[model samples]
Structures are given as structure tokens and as C-alpha cells.
Target: MTTKITWLGHSAFQVETAGKTILLDPFFTGNPAATVSADSVAADAILITHGHGDHIGDTVDIAKRTGALVVANFEIVTWLQGQGLENVHAMHIGGSHAFDFGTVKLTIAHHGSALPDNSYGGNPAGIILKTADGNIYFAGDTALFSDMQLIGDEDLEVAVLPIGDNFTMGPDDSVKATNFLSPRIVIPQHYNTWPLINQDTAAWETNINLQTSATPVVLQVGEHFDLS
Candidate 1:
């Protein structure tokens, strides 16, 4: 079966595969483009890249309401557990864990993960999801790093990366990242959220097309795509 991915604005996304639905960085409750609130969204699994409010937004409420498994680093999992979230799966960078949907490998990310209350949230991470169809990478907030080539050396079909600067890599660096990762398809995220990270995504895609062989796929908020 093919995997379907939906962009929910900012760093939020919905990925469906093997009859299971997974959510990534679900920060849609107060998101300007948010179509549904945390209480309305349902997921079989929820993956968090870090513990920042924007990244971990509404996870506790959503997990409590939907009984979804919250997956993240050990500390974040512990914190969520303290919040009374029963189903929490903790994994560290370079570790792989098997779930009902598939296996997920936590890759390294150069970023911070302090919780809203300023508690340690564990090391930030990028997620590499291996499903029945193909492998996918979600490069949570990070800067340009050469190790991306090593991480992308799998059967990668799609990669979701941040092209928003100030908090992440800019368009130029993201183009280089695409060249290094060389995924079949690339989607830009974490941009146009606010003035600090605002960017011309179309322009970024055009630049990436000239710099890499990977096809850039820019999706509108609430838009969905099926990976072949």
C-alpha cells in the first residue's frame, strides 16, 4: 500500500501507512491554518521531534483524548507520563523501535528540546520511518549537517525538511541538504509561519530544482499526497 502524507502547516504533518495513522509535531490547536483542534484530531501514533511548545503543542491533550501512543526521547516520554499520558514510547538517537505501523529510527538533529516548563526534554532528533512502501525522513528543526548523507543512504523515497531560517536552515542550506540526502521527493516545511521564519517556498523550490535531482513538492496547508 502507498503512504499518504498531509501537511498541516508549520512542522505538523499526518502520515498514513499500513492502515495506521501517525502525527508529527502536531501544533495545530492555535495554528493560524489549523482546521481542527487537538481534541478533534485522532491518531494511532504521535511522534515528537522535541519538547518545545511549538513542537510538542497539544500532545498531552491529544494523547489523553485519543489514547494515541506518544513517541519521543526518553525524557519527553517521562514528562508526558508524568502528565498522565499512559501510552508513551521512548527512543534515543541512533536507536530503532518497532511499532504497530512500522520501524522508526531516530536520527541525530542539532537542536534543543527544553520543555515548556524549562525541563530537559532529551536530545533533539530526526525521524526515519520505514514502512512497507519505502523509507521517509522527517528532519526536525536543524541546521546544515554533512551526516545527512549517511542518514539518507537508505531506501528513501521522501524527505520532509525545514527551510525556514532563524530557527532552522535557510533556502540555500536546504537546497544543499536536498543534494546530500537525494531523496526521490522533497517537501519543505516550517516556513511562512511568522516573520522570523517567513520564506518564499516557491523560490526555494525553484532553486532546489536547479541544485538537485530530487523533485520538490510544496504542499498547501491541509493538502495531501500519496507517495508511489
Candidate 2:
């Protein structure tokens, strides 16, 4: 089996695997670094990592347009339901749910969760995808935490981590995180979207390469990585 992962800028990603199209943190409309528009995105399911405006970008509109199921925490699910959205799967940290293509486990993350409208967004989380081809870890907006070692048990094939500071883990902490998850390949996200979080990806890559065995795959806005 083969899986294709595309970076959509600012932590957003398009994962095509197991005959399903999955979108992670589909922020785009107002994303300064986004390469595609909200109208151009289509997916079988949408997975939201948190309730921040940047992470939940265009989720309601896109779900309404494509009828794609929205997967999120209970609080965020209820918020979306109030918006007249019916297709949603409410999940929580440490819980795993089975989908048509694979399993999605909501993992722990250190961050805030508040909807754009000031409603409760539940707890922030990272996503662990157990797919046919490999396991993928998408670390949403978060600071470095110790439990990441648990994710290593899955034998992570790829780990998509936020390298932007101020709001999330910067290069130093992110490198330490790699020591925990130990994925075969690591991809940097959530950087360069804003000046406050802007980073030198090349420096990050070099640091990781020197310190860890995992290869850092730095991608552009629309770049992709194909794995088996």
C-alpha cells in the first residue's frame, strides 16, 4: 500500500491513504501561507486538532459544502452541531475511533482550546493515524510533553510536528520531541506562517539530522511526501 501526504501550509495537510482522503486542520481561507483555497479542498473526513481559528479554518463551511464528517473533541463537536452540522464524530484524548480506512487516536497535547466564537473547544490534542501502510502522528499546536514516548510504541513512520515557537514547540524542543517519538521521517510544520512563529527550517533540519536518526523532510506550501 502507498500513502501520500501533502503539506497545505500552516499545519494543514491532505492525507490520501487506504482509499480515503483525510484532511488535517483544514485552515486556508484566511491563512497567509496557505497554498490552496477552501473552495478547492475536498475530503472524505476532516480532523480538527483544536478550536483555534487558525486550526479550525473553514471547517464548518467546507464540511457543509462537501458533507465530509468532522472529527473533533466533544466540546467542539457540540459547537459545530449548534452550527447546524450533523455529520460529526466527537472524540477525546486517549480515545481511539475506527473509521472506514483506519483508526484515529486522539493523543494528548499541551495547548489551549477555545473556539473562535469564545465557546468551549474542549481539550487540544494530537492525532495518531494507524493506517494500512504506516502510522502517522500529527502533532497539532502544542508544547513539548513527555507522553510522546507512548506514540513511539506505534512505530511511527512519519511525524508531522510544529516547529513554530511562541505558540508551539520551537526547533530545540521539537528536536527533543523527535527523541521521544523517533519516527522514521520527520516533517516540520506551523512555521513561517507569521513573523512571531517564523523559523529557519534549514537550520532545524540540520539540527535534527545531526542529533537524531530520523530524516527531516521540510516541504513547501504545496509539496508532498510519498511513503509506503
Candidate 3:
């Protein structure tokens, strides 16, 4: 089995594996850099890392249209429920659940989460996807932390991290994260969508390759990469 990972610009990604297509942080409706529109996105499941507007973009609209199961933290689930969405799974950090395609585990992420309506969004989280192809870690909007070494124990094939500064870890700290996780491949995201987070992925890749054993895979918006 192979996992096809698609970068939808910024932190949004479309992952296809085991006959299922999952959307992570599907923020595209208002995304200036999004290549695909919300109406065209098809998802078996929608995984959310936080409740920020940019991260939670079009979740309710997409779920309503596609009936995709919305997997998120308690607060997000509750908020979605209030919006009359019945297909929702409420899980918190350190929780894992199995679906038709594979298993998903929510990990710790250092960030704030307030819903679009300004309600508490619970603890932010990262996502670990275990599939037939390999284990993938989506470190959604996180800073560099020492426990990343622990996440490396899963024998990760790919680690998708944020290299944009201001709101998330800069290239320097993200380079440190790559060394700690030491995954076979690393992809940088969450940058260049806005002026505040504009970054040079080429320069960041150079830093990562020089400092860590992992190879950096940089993708253009709307590009797809397959995992071996």
C-alpha cells in the first residue's frame, strides 16, 4: 500500500491510503493560496488539529456536503454538534481511534484553540496516522519540543512540520525537530500563505538536510507526493 499525500497549501493536506481519503486541517474556502475549492474536496474523514479559523476552515460546510466524519477534540465536536453535524468523533490528546482505513492518534501540541465562535476549543493536538504504507506524523501548528524524540519511536516514514515563523516554529527550531524525530522524510508547511508567515522553504530545507539525517521534500501548492 502507498499513501498519497497532497499539499493544499499552508497546513492543509489530503491523504489517501487504504482506499480512504482523509483531509487534515482543510482550510481552503478563504485560503488565498488554495488550489482546490471546498466544493471539490471529497473526504472519508476530516481530521482537525485545532479550532482556529484557518485550521477549521470549511469543516462544517464540507461535512454537511460530503457527510464525512469530523474527527476532532471535545470542544470542536461539541461546537460542530451545535451546528447540527451528527457525524463527529470527539477525542482528546493521547487518544487513538480506528477507522476503516487505519488508526489515528492525537498527540500533544502547544497552541491555543478557540472556535470560530470564540468558544473554548480544548487542547490543540498533532495527529499520528498509522496505515499500511507507513506511519505519518502531522505536527499541526506546533513548536519544537523534546518529546518529539518519543514520537520518533513509531518508526515514522514522514514528518510534516511547520517551518513558518511568528505563529509556529521557525526554520531553526523546525530543523531541531527534524533531528529529534529523525524520520526518513520531512515536509515543510504552514508558510507563505500570509505575509506574517512568509518563509523560504529552500533555505529551510538546506538547514534541515545539513543538520539531520532526514531528507526534506518540499512540495508546491496542490502538488502530491507518494510515500514508499
Candidate 4:
């Protein structure tokens, strides 16, 4: 099966592979960058990277409506259960789980995990997906770290990173991250959602071409690319 990844704006992504539709950080409710509505998207599974409002956008509504399995850290899982969600699976950093769709391994993410209500969200995480088509790494809101070289050891087909400066790493650091992750394709996100986090993706793509070996693919909101 082919793996298709769609940028749902910001750090949100829709991954379709192995007959499953998985959503990562599906924040569409108030996202200015989102072209689709939270009411329209379909999912078999939802993965949350942190408890940030943006990252947790519309997850409850979407998951409840679609009966999709929700994967997240313990704290976020507890929070979801508190909000009356029953189809949640909790995992933490360094933990890996196999699902009907693929295998997901959570890696360390240097960021906060406070929920929308300021509840403890648990440790933030980056996700590594091993699928039939290829491997993928989704580096949720994070700063550049050296351990990404170890992540690169997975032979990633693509790496999705945040490039917004105020909340996450800016473009320059994202370029450096690509150098570490060394994926065949690198995609940028978590930027241009608002004026505070706005960035010029074109310039960042140029820098990625010059400084890194990965091909930079800057997808527009609602655009998608195939893997394998």
C-alpha cells in the first residue's frame, strides 16, 4: 500500500496508509491555516504530540465522532478520558506500539505538554512511523536536538518539522535539523498560522537545498504528497 501524507496546516497532518487514515495534531477549529473543517475530516486513528491547544485542536470532537483510536501520552490520555473519551491508548516517550495501520514509536520532544485547560499533558513527543510503504518521523513542536542523528538511523523517507519561531524552531534551526535527520524528503510546518509565527517557506527551502542533503518540499495548506 502507498502512504500518502497531507498537510492539514500548521503541525497537523493526515496520513493514509494500509487502509487506515491517521491524523497527527489535527488542529483545525481555530486554525487560520486550515482549509478544511474539523467536521469534515475522517480518521481511523489520531495521534497527539503534546497538550498544546493548537496540537490538540478538535481531537475530541473528531475522535468521538469518527470512533477513531486516540494515541497520546499518559497525561493527555487521562485528560481525554476525563472528557469522556473511551477509545484512547496511552504511551510515553521511548515506547512503541503496533496498530492495525503501522508501528508508532514515540521519541523525546523538547517542549511543553500543558493541555488547553492548563492540565498537565505529560511529556512531549516526536513520532516515528514504520509502515509498509516507508518510514516517517513527525517531529512535533520542538527545538533542534542532536539525537535526531539517531532518528535518522531509521532511514526515514520523510521528516515533518515545525518551522514557526515564536512557538517552535524557526527556519534556520529546522535546516540544521534536516542535516541531522537526513531524510530523503523534509517538510516544514507549524508556521504561517498567524502573524506571530509567520515565515517565508521559500527562503527556508533554499537554505535546506544549500545546507542539507534532503529535498525540501514546502506543501501548501491542504496539499499532499505520496511516499513509496
Predicted candidate 3 versus true structure: per-residue lDDT over 1-228, tens digit per residue: 689999999899999999989999999988998999999999999999999999999899999999999999998999999998999999998889998878999999988899998999999999999988899999998888999999988899999999888989999999999888889999999999989999988899888888899999999998988986
TM-score of 3: 0.98
lDDT of 2 by residue, 178-218 (tens): 99999999999999998998999989999999999999999
Instruction: Choose 2 or 3, whichever is better by lDDT.
Output: 2
Full-model lDDT, candidate 2: 0.93
Which consecutive 10 residues in model 4 have the weakest lDDT in total? Answer: 161-170
Give a tens-digit lDDT track for model 4, residues 2-75.
89999999899999999999999999998888999988999999999999999999999999999999999999
lDDT of 2 at 37: 91
Write out the backbone clash pairs for model 3.
none
Model 2, position 174, has a per-residue lDDT of: 95
Summarize candidate 1's per-residue lDDT along 20-71 as a digit string, tens digits.
9999999986777677679778799999999998889989998888889999
Provide the lDDT at 70 for model 1.
90
Q: Which ten residues in a row have the lowest lDDT in candidate 3?
A: 200-209
Please list the residue runs of candidate 1 whose C-alpha ends up more than 4 Å from where it truly belongs after superposition.
none
The lDDT values for all models are 0.90, 0.93, 0.92, 0.94
C-alpha TM-score for every candidate: 0.98, 0.98, 0.98, 0.98
